[model samples]
Target: MQGPHSPAPPVDVQPASWRDLSSIRELEKLCFGRDAWPWIDTLAALTFPQTVRLKAVSDEFVVGFIFGDQRRLKRTGWIASIGVHPDYRRRGIGRTLLVACEDLLGMPRVRLSLRGSNDAALRLYQQAGYVRIDTWKRYYRDGEDAIIMEKVR
Candidate 1:
């Protein structure tokens, strides 16, 4: 049995495999809506050895996921994608996944792009020490500008 004040069960973060493609695809659709990646892209991200893919799992179900691509020659890394299942938001799952991905990338700086209008995501990144570095005009398919943010370690 667990006490009321007992800590919540620990979430396991591990490298994602091709077997998780469907779960990741579903989660991307839920978190990103129209911006979700196509199935091919999601599959590639999972199987590409150079890419950093991490999933937050509890009871063998993926609750959150993140992907990072490192460019060692440029000393930078890009957060390819991040998404948390709707039921898992606001519980630090996204943050945990992001941190783990960054650690795996081992780059001098980590960069990510988010819709300028996404206040919740912006707040999360800001709180995680990411600073807005630039903005791209009409960056999204829907023509929404993208705010580029960076965190230097």
Candidate 2:
């Protein structure tokens, strides 16, 4: 028997593999909608040896995912993508996934781009210590501007 005030168990974070592509693709569609990457790019992120791919799994399904690209020459890492299933939002899953990718990237600075209109994402990134650095006008296919944010370690 458990007490009414008992805290829930913690979720697990792990490196994702190509086998997780299907689950990740589903989550991508749910979170990014029209901005989701194509299947080929998703596959590459999961299977590429040097790429950092992390997934937040609960109940044996992927709830969130993040991909990081390490640019050694540039001395920075870029967050290629991040997504949390709609059912899993606001539970710190996205933040956990981002932190895991940052750790794996092991770079001095990490950067990500988001639609300028995505207030929720902007707030999350801001709370996690990322600051807006630049903006790309009409960067998305739908002609939405993208705000670039960076966290220096």
TM-score of 1: 0.93
Task: Locate the minimum summed-lDDT window of 10 residues in model 2.
Answer: 1-10
Quote each prediction's TM-score.
Answer: 0.93, 0.92
Segments in model 2 whose C-alpha atoms lie over 4 Å from true places: 1-9
In model 1, residue pairs whose N, Cα or C atoms come closer than 3 Å (at least 3 residues apart or on different chains), thus clashing, are: none
- For residue 46, model 2's alpha carbon misses the true position, in angstroms, by 0.5
The TM-score, computed over Cα atoms with residue i paired to residue i, of candidate 2 is 0.92
lDDT of 1 by residue, 59-138 (tens): 77898999999888899999999988887788899889888888999998999999989998899899988999999999
What candidate 1 gets wrong by more than 4 Å, as runs, is 1-8
Q: Native-vs-model 2 lDDT?
A: 0.90
Candidate 2 Cα RMSD (Å): 2.3
Can you write out model 2's per-residue Cα lDDT over 1-153, one digit (the tens) per residue? 448997644568998999998999999999888888999999999988669999888867788899999998898999999888787788898888888889989999999999999998999999999999999999999999999999999
